[model samples]
Target: MKRRPRRSVPALLTALVLLATCVLLAVSAIQLILGERPWISYDTVAATLHDLRWTDVLPAVAGGVLALAGLVLLLAAVLPGAATVLPVDGSFHSGVARGSYRSTLQAAAAGVDGVSGARVKLRSRRLKVRVDTTRTRPDGLADAVRAAVTDRLDRIGPATRPAVAVRVRDPRRTS
Candidate 1:
């Protein structure tokens, strides 16, 4: 059985705090039972609550912050991110990482005639290819990149076919 990962920081801090509180309460109870002076008195706590000030508000603010922190930790523990896997052509599905696919697409795009370099972003249903040319601004650069990337995608055989959108960037502007 696969075990889910837990958020340890919040849990550990909460446990430590509760343990300290229990120990303090136990000590106070023992002091009272032994007819000794207790660390905290009920009358002082009541007086503080009745005459609340900024210092009293600090505890409430701290509690609120702790609650928010615990809530975020709980959500993170419960809802984990989905694994990104690209299905390739074969009897057994090959898991391709997102970065690997982007790199493959970039290499394919850069192989085009006038392209000096390429940047590829592979989304769920869209492939954005940005190609940079040194000085040669050839016509149909977008079409060339689209075709090359499309052919590569077909060979890769991802589960879903992403629409290839090509954008050509000319770093040095020529008249």
Candidate 2:
């Protein structure tokens, strides 16, 4: 099942600002209709706008803040978040959580001879496995870990095969 997208911070902030403005305007209009004068005179607002120059610091600061806010919103809208579940195949008819993939890779690497433990990080384009081995020679352990991981990846048959990277570390060195 697909999860709902989380609300973006910029979008939320803009909504709040707009809501507050609407409330204030409504209150002011109500007061004006009852014959009460608005707190800030229209003349004052008109004078401020009239006096605002292109080189003024207030205008520049406001423009910069608005531009930055727009940029952040644009980025948040465009960049997709990490998927909670990955498609077993390109068709996405069946899928599994990302944690399951990591566990599968870790189990495969740990099953390799000389590997005492394994940590796996799976990204969109890369599968990084760090293996702690009992063997003194890192070379043999590294090769074995790579082959086991490669076989596991082939079995999964993801839409794109992530490049497998194996790093072997001595088990004793961590202690």
Candidate 3:
């Protein structure tokens, strides 16, 4: 099952700004109708607009800022977000959370002999397993970890099997 990310934050902010503008305009209109002074001076705004020119530095900077903000909002609305869950391979429809999948692979790698610690990173189509060992010479540790992780992946049966890469690090070596 595919899930789309929510774009509520941008939408909510845009709505709030529009609402505030509308409320301000309505209040100003009511004050004018009652023959009371409005919060903003209309004459001053009209004079400023009349004096303003397209080539003015202030107007150019303001226009650029507004265009940049619009471009950002447009991109946020159009771009697709990363998947939160990975699909599992099976006759019945099922999926697995990325955290759970990574943990399972890490456990498999850590269970191997001579491995002091294991860290697994799950990418779109890559599984990187970093193994730490106390043994000074970790000759075949990387291969062992790779095989174990691959076996676990097979059992889990993800829809897309990522390529497994194992790296063995010796704690005693500074380099």
Candidate 4:
């Protein structure tokens, strides 16, 4: 089963906005019912709305902003979030956290003979490994790192195996 990241941020922001609007409307209604000064003046609002014309720039801009906001909210609500955990092959109930997965790959790459330091990035379906070595002629080091990382990935057996790309750089070279 694919695990998706939580959409709590957008959901929370939308809820807060709606709650504030509802509270403001309810307070204004209560003030009107009690014959007190409303938080928002209905007469002024009515006059402004009545005077607004379709050709006015203010109304057109406001409408456009509202439409764009609605579109963004709709897309956020409907679209699926990124995966938080990758599924394990041959296991329906188990998955690996992306952090741990990357760590494992980094360890595997770093364990190679000439690698002094290693960094791994897993994005979408790509696994990028950058290794630094003290050796000036780091010939075939990239292939070695790639082979080691690939072997570790095979042992882990993730449902969707990412393509591994390895880069070897000398520590003394700035480029």
Ranking by lDDT: 4, 3, 2, 1
User: For residues 45-89, could you state the per-residue lDDT of candidate 3 as single tens digits?
Assistant: 899989999989989999999899899889889997656677888
State the displacement of the C-alpha of residue 172, model 1, in Å, after optimal TM-score superposition. 4.4
User: Which 10-residue span in candidate 1 carries the lowest summed lDDT?
Assistant: 1-10
Which residue pairs in model 4 clash with each other?
Answer: none
Top candidate (TM-score): 4
**Top candidate when judged by lDDT against the true structure:** 4
TM-score-best of 1 and 2: 2
* lDDT against true structure, model 3: 0.89
List per-prediction Cα lDDT, in the order shown.
0.79, 0.82, 0.89, 0.90
lDDT of 2 by residue, 2-97 (tens): 232465676888899999988887887787788898765667889999999999999999999999988988888877777777767755477667
lDDT of prediction 2: 0.82
Worst window of 10 by summed lDDT in candidate 4: 166-175
Q: What would the per-residue lDDT of candidate 1 be over residues 54-100, giving only the tens digit for each residue?
A: 56767789889989977887786678543355666668746677677
Q: Model 4: residues >4 Å from true position, as ranges?
A: 172-175
Clashing residue pairs for model 3: none
Root-mean-square deviation per candidate: 6.2, 4.3, 3.0, 2.4
